[model samples]
Target chain A: MTTLVSEAIRAPYDFLAWLVGLWSDALYAVGDALGIGMLEYVFMHHAFLVGTLIAVMAPLVGTFLVHRQMALIGDALAHTAFAGVAVGLFVNSILGTGISPYLTAVVVAMLAALAIELISEVTDAYNDVSMAIVLSTGFALGAVLISVNTGGLAVGINQYLFGNLATVSRENAVLLVVLFLLVSVVVTVTYKQLLYVTFDETAARVAGIDVTWYNRLMTTLTALVVVGAMQIMGVILVAAMLVVPVAAAAQVARGFRESLLASVVLAQIAVLVGITLSYRYEATAGGTIVLVAVAVYIGMVLAGKLQSRRGVSEEAGTGSVAREIDAGTGESTDD
Target chain B: MSLEGIPSVGVGGVETSRESAEAGEGRRGEGTADADRVVDAVDLTFGYAAAPVVESVSFGVDRGEYVGIVGPNGSGKSTLLRLVLGLHEPDSGHARLLGHPSLAFAERERVGYVAQDVTENTKRMPITVAEVVLMGRFPHAGFGRVTETDREHAREALRTVGIERLADRKITALSGGQRQRAYIARALAGEAELLVLDEPTVGVDAESVDAFFDLLADLNDEGMTILLVEHDIGAVLERASRVICLNREVYFDGSPAAFAGSDALERAYGTNLGLGAKTETDSRGDGS
Candidate 1:
């Protein structure tokens, strides 16, 4: 059985290697032809599965981040993650020790998230501004560290800058699958609590729902989902996943629950399609997925506008969509 | 859980309200001022700042009293409820539920508070009507899997507010009046002795507003003492038994009849009291 399994693993590699070699050559030709593909095209040595998974989960997670009004925070945390990965790699290389750079990245990402929260609380300024400042400062710190330790691939950190699915690894794929499951389960179990707090924080508080802890928990989860699994996708557009799907879902969904479900479904579909297209055309998966999600959002807006010819949406758009549904249905929303 | 078996914990509790309501009912037989101490506040001077929203606002609400808190928009009537619920610390003076200090945390079990705006956080996730109501049981939703008794209480709370069908509906989807009912149901689930709602009828249709007032009246009849902070002075003059006015200080605390029978309230409100309106106010002010 051991020999059979060993043979099974060895046999697939012959064809896999051939396909990869040909695929890499075609990618080089395409990049050369396009005149826009960056220098990182040489390492067509990535896991397609990992890139696809990242494409799917990033936006799915991004939806919650956007809803929670944490997009800029996401961007900042991704930058901080670079520092974490670099530091971890630096330590491992210097000591001739073995440690996972990505796992270390998760710890640093969490600290960055925590720091952002603390800073936001102290500053009381608009959240996105703080996130931007944190992101720039974090990346600067990472750059300094990279400069201090110029042994390996700092210049080749285009995956962190301009994403390349061709460089995603097996570890990245495993991490992503785990993070996705964690996010999915947490969301499902606390779905109602999240909904209540989101819709009416004050009422939830009055009703004795602890809004503070849940808010922190959600951010913590998003940080984990982002940094733990980001190797599959890259930092160039991590916030896209957190924002685009929900933005699109909100455009179409009638209510909050519908929005959540729609966002997840839309995100998953967008990622899967983005992956297949990226695979076939050698396009950037993150960019393609975000673009598709935007396309879906536009479609939702058009569909909604087309459905309401009399501009009932315009009227209710001022106050609430609930009233519009009630108006159209003739169901005396007599509250 | 059986209502009887549920040991009252928070100030928003059935036992507390029932006792207070019964005590209020007992006062009707006596018909004397000595028995009118449903909610006793002593030397109360509280607000957001040193200026004080409620200063020397000394007063007592008799059991089963329907008290209306009215004044101009910034008069601090809503602040008074927050003080009562112990959500805010009073700068000075003292407020109490029954006989306990206003800051008493456990005393919250007897006080059900509804705010002017019950909006979603817009950042958190959605929760169902049933689950929102069950939040009243936060003190109880522990290792025990929200027992059958807790579910029954939640259901009863919904039925009491006349929104039983909306148990599973999202709070974000309900109409304003229905949403208010859900809020009321949450309070009832807590079994509050004093149900306090700030602007319970604001922005609701007149019919829905009337329905809400009517429900509060029914709760009042069933021995629940209600303290309402409202902008709809017209309906309030008809509903509340005692009226308290605040203008950064206690202006008036008395029966609705005093407002209807005299020119004092008309002058205070800065509106001419029409003859027919006075007659209508008198009829409703003298609670059955």
Candidate 2:
């Protein structure tokens, strides 16, 4: 029965592997046609795929988080996910098991997410002190665990810390695909509830949307996003993918849906361009992507300033028009 | 208008109503007690800390009745409203919304709420006026797609509030008065039987505040039940059919005229001497 269940779960991953193979072959053809050196490698193809998916899911969840002023929650969860990786490595060394560290990270990060939520619920606040404690505890645990292991585990830790583009293995790519689908499907299904909760907790509660449950779900999803992005963006800088693009989009986008779409588009530019630049310069992919995203944010801020300066006069005109209509309708309704 | 025939209950009627509500709660399932009342609170009490914020509050808002709650700043008016809406569970007794226990009241779409300018805090959020109004339909839609009919209702609600022209504009771009109307439109879109507003005109310009009250009067005239919590005693007296003066407890529950005639305002506002002094100074400042 266990084997059957495991096979049932593996079926989708197998299909995703096939899809990844097809993607790599297509990239190879494109590389030959465009004479791109980096796209010739299978690892580069996987890196691009993972980066693209990260761009989509990161901001898709980040939009809700950033608007709610909970952007730091992503950073907090990423640190806990790192601790989770340490736990996995520690247990694997002792037990001689082949369990994926990312799986353990997912489990630990989700638990930490729930802890953060529960603490907030009990204390009636999402204060920075508790979050700081959680973050430090995670990094401290990871450091201690890595020191205690004293072997090849410490050598592989750099990839998880700062992230390595060349380390985007086929299995890691497939895992990300699964996470992308999960995050996308869940967010799509619960979009309205999540949006309502994020926008106004009191009003959402009044609407009977179970604000607490949605909050828990949101944090849990943040844990998943942090873990998935950690494979390429690393533990330290993964949250940049979730926050920076969303902030950039908020600078110019005039509506929630528009901001969400704009953030995804902006993240795509950051990831794709940053990947290419990192390859050219031999820099860390995560650091390059965040730098590009920050640059995009600065550009958006300037554009937003220009738009607002122009919007002032336009808004004054609309204000007068609105008053006129209000007066007209007030009289008509009275009559 | 069914309540029009009932004589205006004066200050003395508070005791009688409490007794009747208690009697009603004693035999709750009899079907005659609370079936017609949209909001029924019988000895409801709640507090965040040691001391009770709302204490032994008892009242019932009949169908289509416009009730306004007025109190001092810390008089637990908002807390009482939260208790009525089941956002905060009462410490003792019970509050019922639309004939069901407030906390367990499942048919949430039947009620609409507009609180004191939440948009002021979320001004940077990129949600359009149309989208905010569309949230009224969210409870109806649940996990399903927002249907065309839902959009039509939202449009109709916007038109009713006379802001259909600005439907596509960002919500934060609107004036405080206009934003409150959009919230009302949201409630209207939901087909809510009861509309609740807590200090709905805070930060609104004086001219717009008058217009906002007129809008409320118009909604009430159209047979919509309204429960309003306002700091502006004059506005509530001018608009509400019934006035509830509260200070941790119900000071008075009666007609607006009766409320004005009684010393309930003085008793409620006088409990906090600093607030009373501040009000005097504020009025003096306004005169100067």
Candidate 3:
């Protein structure tokens, strides 16, 4: 029965791996044609694939999180994911078993996500005090666990901490594809409810959307995104992908749907450009991506300021007209 | 006073109007006989701490009735609204919305809520006026896709509220009064029969407040049951057909004219120290 259930899940991952192989070949061909040196290597192909998926899902979940003032929750979850990776490494060393640390990280991060939700629910507020405590606790646990198993494990930890472009394994890329599918499908199904809850908790409740259930779902999805992005983004800089793009999008987009689309587009730019720049400069991929994202954010802020300044006079005139129309209709309705 | 296994108290203070007297009896045994009672609270009590914020507040709002609940700040007016909407569970007794217990009330689309300037808190959220209004149809659409008919209803609601021209504009860019209208349009798009507003004119300008009340009165005339909770006594007295003066309990529940004639406002507001002091003791006795 267990094998059957595992097979059901494994079949999709196998197909995704096959798709990734095809993508690598296509990239190789394109690299030969366009004379792009970086795309010639298989690891670089995996890196780009992983980076692209991270760009899509990170900001997709991040848009809701950023607007809701829960951006810190992403940073908190990433720290906990580091603890998860530490636990996986410790267990593997002790038991001499071949288990993926990313798999364990997913489990541990999801647990931390629920713990955060539970604490908030019990406290009757999402205070930063509890979040800060949880974050430090996760990091402390990871540090302590890693210190206890100090040798080859310490060397490999740098890849998880700062993120290495050359270390993008095929299996890790496949895991990200699965996470991407899960996050996107859930968000698509519950977009309206999530938007309502994020925008106005009271009205959403009165409208009969179970706000608590949706909040839990949101945090859990954030955990998945954090861990998946951890491969290319690393534990330290993973959260920037979740926040910077969304912040930039909010500056320019007029509507929620527009902001969501814009954030995803902006993140794609950050990821693709940052990856290329990282390869050329021999810089850390996560650091490069975050730097690019922040640069984009600065550009958007300036653009938003200029746009508002230009529209100020036009807006003032229309504002009065709108109010006058409201008053007129009110009087006409009063009989 | 015990927290556990407290028996539901019998209904009292149902004398808001002749209609409510009948509705109260309908609640006791006849059930569906008072289908017009859009909101009914029988000895409802709740508090965050030990001292109950709202205590034994019993009243019934029949269809098409314009009811206004006026009280001082921290007098549990908003908390009472939460109870009626089933946002918080009552410590005891029952609060019903459209005949169902508010907590378990399933037909949510029938009731509309216009909160006190939700935009003040969510000012930075990037949502257009059209998008916000479309949320009213969310309860109806559930997991299904929002159809063209839903969009049509949302558009009609925006037009009704006189913000059809500003449909594409961002909600945060609008003034306080305009934001409230957008919220009302959202409620209307859901085709709500009972429109509930909690201090809808908090930061609105004086002229817009008058216009907002006029719009509300017009909706009331069109057979919509309106329940408004406001701290402004004069506004409630001038606009609402029925007035409920509350401070921890139902100090007075009757017509606006009767409420104005009586010292209900003074007692409820605690302006008349002697009467207010006496009433506080009396309510505490009743609560315990």
Candidate 4:
């Protein structure tokens, strides 16, 4: 009976599968023309798909976190997710269940996110302190869990730790697709409200925007993005995707929406190129992706400095006239 | 000071207009003085770490009144505003906003608040002036997209604050005075009946400070009840119809002239405040 229900669902799934096949064929044709033979493998296709989805999600959520100066939240959540994965493994061994560790990571990461928020709100502790406490606790828990379950769990944990491209199973890729859609819809629907809260939470509260709810929504979304990115970017380097692309985007973009858009574009470029490089060199996919993102960030910083210097030089032609205007208006302390 | 919770004694048997809707019109006939009172704080007391910041402060702001609250630094000026806005709960007494207990005040859009020097928090955000102003419309928009009417109101608010030209400019790029104006525009865009400003001109240039007060005076003249918490006693006294002198308590609540005449300033601030300068200068010329 369950098979019949699945069969009914299989029709649309098969249609989707067929469409994905057509797209993959087109990508392969491009790869053949470009002479990048690694792109034709089924595992390579999975890696690229997961990477692209992660690229879209990381910066979409990261821009808000970065702007709020909570960039380390992604790192904290990722480490918490590692503990969650350990719990899943331990529980599965005990119960003889075959549940995916990523599922448990999602649950654990979300709880940790809420815990982070609650600790800060209740104690009036700075957000970083909350993050630091949670980070240490989470890493310690994961380490203990792994040590205790060394016989059963030690084999497959490295894939989550450093991310292996070949380890992104079809089921995990499908899960990532679901996560991408969920995150995209949520972030899009709540974009304006989140932006309002992100800019000035006190004013947003005064404006009756349910600031706490949006804050929770943002942190929850961060947890979800951290889990999704973990499949490809790994536990350690997942947050790099969240922060580096946004840092680069901020150097170039003048507005919030522009920054968000540019970050996604930058992340996409980094992910695709990183995946290709990792595939060719048999390197850790997460590290390669982060390295590319960092390189782009450095490039943007240099470019921004050069562009501003040129502007200053052009203003120098007008003597102290430009300087006078700038002096009249106090320098911005935005960063 | 021991960090112990003070028992909050809420006002009892005070019927909200909603609860007593059937008899509200009849009560109005009895002249209970509830018609125009935007804020009515009765013996409000708040503290942090069991040390009182606002101690048994009470004041009422009637409709169309510009009330300026003046106090020395850390004398609970901002804390008093927070109590009225329900951002902080008073420990020992009650505060009502628009005839409802502040915590239960449902008409959120009716009261607007401009916090002190939020520029530090907002500067890093890459938001445009219009977008910041549009946030004022959030309560009215309510899970719906901002309407064209909302945008028009935001634009009009910008025009009112005389920063309509900077509407498209990023908030981080604006001058201190311009940012303050933009914040005022954000509050104004809500079209609230009561505007609560907490030191809205801290970093403004001298020339712009005069202009900022002029804008507030203009808003008050147009019937928006303004509660301004200011450190610039002289400028605020010149504009506000009533002055509320607070130093952890309500020292005086009366006309600005009476505030000048009374020793409340000296008692509250522990000094004859600079408003004395203006008072002495006036007496030197007219001896009245």
The number of the candidate with the highest DockQ is 3
Give all candidates' CA lDDT scores: 0.64, 0.86, 0.86, 0.79
Name model 3 segments beyond 4 Å from true: A1-6, A331-335, B1-33, B272-288
Which residue pairs clash within candidate 2? Answer: A256-B126
lDDT per residue as tens, model 2, A199-307 = 8788888999998899899999999999999988899999999999999999999889999999999999999999999999999999999999999999999999999
Candidate scoring better on DockQ of 1 and 4: 4
Report the CA-based lDDT of candidate 3 relative to the real structure: 0.86
What's the DockQ for every one of the candidates? Answer: 0.14, 0.53, 0.59, 0.24
Q: State candidate 4's DockQ.
A: 0.24
Residue A322 lDDT (model 2): 82
TM-score, every prediction:
0.70, 0.92, 0.92, 0.86
Clashing pairs in 4: none
User: For residues B11-50, what per-residue lDDT tens digits would candidate 1 score against the true structure?
Assistant: 2334333433343354456664534455766566675655
Q: What lDDT does candidate 3 reach at residue B275?
A: 61
Worst 10 residues of 2 chain B by lDDT: B1-10
Candidate 1 accuracy as lDDT: 0.64
What DockQ class does candidate 2 belong to? medium
